[model samples]
Target: MSILETTASILKLMVERQGAIRISDVIHHLGMPKSTASRVMSQLESYGYLEKDEIHGTFLPGPLIMSASHLVNRQLTLNDHVDAALRSLCERTGYTGYISMLDNQEILVLRVIHGRQSLPVVTWPGSRSPAWGTSTGRALLARFTDTQLHDFFASPQVVSQLTGSQQDVSMLVATVARTRDAGYATAVNESVADTASVSCAVGDPATHDAVAFCLSFPQQLATPEELQRIATLLKEAALTIAGKTGDTQVSSPL
Candidate 1:
């Protein structure tokens, strides 16, 4: 692999481990030379993207690298603020509210607020939903490479089960394309009857991996205009959250 790819891979591995990572570990995990891994670590440390603990002698992602992902781990854990936002959304929309992120090919619910209009939101905190059948899933797809998206669409593994709706691959691609243009994704009565959702991808342009954040409501109470409005609101909220958490350069549809 190229030097840049190797460095990026090392950084990803360090983040995944969530703690001080040793150069040896990166070398072993990536099958790269120890000297090359050490050099990468040195460069990352010089850029303030990784730091060495004197006591541990291991490297951990520094504040800068954390900011690149919008400090997603930190921001998502801000319980008080997220709760207030969820409560506000529920009050304004008269429907349940939720925040979620993409994990592989699944949507992982991070928070939820129960309102009068509640469905079988089997998705709970730390739980996941398939990425192909939901609005949040489509939004996440907006961040994939064109090649990756095309391959995913062509792959037989792309699951689609919205009853009486376009479950074909072409339809899925078109939907994602529209989502990319609109800066959000929407699903109506697809995951659940009379349910609606709008989602946008939160990501670091440098990493090219999407961390989607979304809001959902009941379809009965949501109009097309309202969905658009909600999408705008969701995008604004995501930007605010991203700014506060340090992810400032999220790719924009505009």
Candidate 2:
């Protein structure tokens, strides 16, 4: 691979780990010669893309990378709207609500709003969950074309992990189809046992940048009718956010 590509990969690894990484860890993980890895590390450190801890002899993301991330986040106007929608959903349903998006084959939680309940599901921003094992993941995945689904299932990031009744790609495809048909997705004891959730996709499908709005509650607390009601509320919130963002192409599950 090109030097630039290698450097970017290393940076991504550091970001994913969210902590300092040793030079040896990079060399071992990337399978690069010690000299080559050292050269790359030096270059990144010099350019302020990485910072080394002198005492621990480990590297971490530097100001430059953080600044770039901050700038990009600032430009994401949709986050503001999504956050407001999450709060509104939580208030209406008395259930914890979240926004998630697919990132590197994982479902990355972007924002969360706690409801009136005392014992809401505990998931933090920046936490990731298996894409095939959660309501939000299924909701987002339902938007993928057949070819994209195949490619995603073939990737190394997607393992043999099964959630709910999905044992193979065919079952996963069927689940996506059901999610599309229902205008939402549901996960009961899939990601976290005894937890139930329903989610709907929001944003323009053409941009391939949709996010899922989800309502999570204790399984025992959610009757069949309550689940359906929460799903309706989630869909409405998603549509409102999509409309505000001028994403008229969002598929209507209704």
Give the per-residue lDDT of model 1 (tens digit) for 162-210.
3445577677778888887787888888876677787766654344434
- Return the top candidate by TM-score: 2
Off by over 4 Å in 1: 1-88, 120-122, 154-156, 159-166, 204-210, 245-254
C-alpha displacement of 37 in model 1, angstroms? 46
After best superposition, candidate 2 residue 237: deviation in angstroms?
A: 1.5
List of clashing residue pairs for candidate 2: none
Q: What value of lDDT does candidate 2 attain over all alpha carbons? A: 0.79
Q: Could you tell me how far off, in angstroms, the CA of residue 119 lies in candidate 2 after the best superposition?
A: 3.7
Q: Please, what are the lDDT tens digits per residue for candidate 2 over residues 33-89? A: 899889989999999888889999999878897788567545666667677778877
